[model samples]
Target chain A: GESVGLHLPTLSVQEGDNSIINCAYSNSASDYFIWYKQESGKGPQFIIDIRSNMDKRQGQRVTVLLNKTVKHLSLQIAATQPGDSAVYFCAERFNNAGNMLTFGGGTRLMVKP
Target chain B: GAGVSQSPSNKVTEKGKDVELRCDPISGHTALYWYRQRLGQGLEFLIYFQGNSAPDKSGLPSDRFSAERTGESVSTLTIQRTQQEDSAVYLCASSNRVGGNQPQHFGDGTRLSIL
Candidate 1:
């Protein structure tokens, strides 16, 4: 079965430091990927997205790197803040999957001041 | 420019009762999706509606779960004879169009608790 999964269940980072979260997906056919942040008691907020054609994509303070060869994806947050503490999820969508996103187990990011 | 909206931010009902969760997608969005988030877990895909096409219910857990959409505007997810395991946050999302590359915007979700 095709699945998306995270490399870590929890990642603790120091404030002002950079944080890296990793994900591994089994479906090589997946062409589009997205990273989302979910705060407590809130919905998953879109952070950034990348296409299989692109190896990296950058947002305001976040970046998503895709390694198609290893079926791996990672989200990097610069200057991690307390507000950045939340669960991060990676989702993949294949061209024939009818626009539905397949999400991986989330990685909980904890920022320490 | 309003985002996706879900009603009754929270709902608590007894086991075996039927509950309907509503989703009001963004204006002009042609795609709608429903997902379930268990405590300390990832989001589980439930169902989705794209334009007038038949909805994709493959993600529905069981026959007890069903969803309806009136055109592309509003969608309702109904769970009959809800069980304790059905407790979770039901999230709604919508995108401008139907395609793998289009990013979907989400709502806060309706927390359903089956007591």
Candidate 2:
């Protein structure tokens, strides 16, 4: 079965520093990818997303990079904050279907103040 | 309007008990989704509802899980005779219209703990 996965289970970074979270997906047919952040006991909050056609996209202080060849994706967060210390997940989607996004195993991001 | 809302922020039940999770998507949003997140695991897609079209339950893990949406408003997910492994946080999300840029607003989620 196809699955979306993360390269690392956890990442620790100093506050105000940059943080990068990586994800690898098995399905190449997915057209869209999204990054979400989840705090303790809270639902996932959308961060940023990029389509398959584009290699990179940025929003606010976050950027999403997609590599179709390697079926890999990454999220870059600028100026990590204590509030940003949470689990980050990457999701894949297609427009034709019901638009449900497949999620990757989350990577826990810890920001030390 | 609220972004998205879910009921019963937490639930604890016996292994043989059933559970129901509710979600109220943002006003006028036409898409709804249900997902489960276990500890140290990724989100598992359970069901998807988009407007008037037939829902997609392809991601449902077993027959114990079922969901339904009324018109374009609220949605409910039911789990029958849940086992201990069924315990997890159930998250709900809604998107404007199934677009690339529109973000899928998520609710706080319902944490289910099976004893």
Candidate 3:
């Protein structure tokens, strides 16, 4: 019944522009969240992750923001590049689930040159 | 260091045939996982193995699907009497430890086609 979902199915962005992907999760017991990038014919690659206690975390040119009050999560990528084009997914881990991750329907990120 | 490795990058078989998928986790990683991804969909958790603990198989879709892990080494997933709905990409991942905070590294999945 509880699930993670994305607001958009596809996002088109210019090479030099920033991109943002949004996710909404219904489970309030989830404590950990992760973002992954899946390219064609490849497995989902780890991007960044954030814990429920923290609101934001930053990586190389990428940031993950979490809002527990709204049960929302977002991934921000700066200076989108061709390599950044992929299907992005947000996953949540419940405290009692023992490392099991609940994944959201992916958002296809298309970076236009 | 090598990342997670899976065998038979692609597999095609007729309905009613059984299939076995293999996964080799990163050396020294203690936790392993299996997931399924249908066309244009996010991954669905299948099973998990951590150390000597009994595997968590709650995500398995049915009794026809099963998996086994040897200690902390390679793991195998078996599907018996496969059906068309079983067609999907089987993904494997491993993490350094058992905590939820640990990041799981994944390998290119095996694409299974049931005809």
Compare the candidates by lDDT and give the number of the best one. 3
C-alpha lDDT of residue A16 in model 1: 100
Q: What is the C-alpha lDDT profile of model 1 across A1-113, one tens digit per residue?
A: 11112334889999999999999987999989999988777788989999999999999999999999999999999999999988898999976897889999899899999
Q: Of the true contacts between chains A and B, what fraction does model 2 have? A: 0.60
* TM-score ranking, best first: 3, 1, 2
lDDT (CA) for every model shown? Answer: 0.90, 0.86, 0.92
- In model 2 chain A, which range of ten residues has the least summed lDDT? A1-10
TM-score on alpha carbons, each prediction: 0.95, 0.91, 0.95
Chain A TM-score from candidate 2: 0.89
What CAPRI grade goes to candidate 2?
acceptable
What is model 2's interface RMSD?
5.0
Best by TM-score: 3
Share of native interface contacts recovered by each model? 0.64, 0.60, 0.62
Writing each residue's lDDT as its tens digit, candidate 2 over A35-99 gives 99887777888888788889999888898889999999999999999999888988888656547
C-alpha lDDT of candidate 2 relative to the true structure: 0.86
- Model 1 TM-score relative to the real fold: 0.95
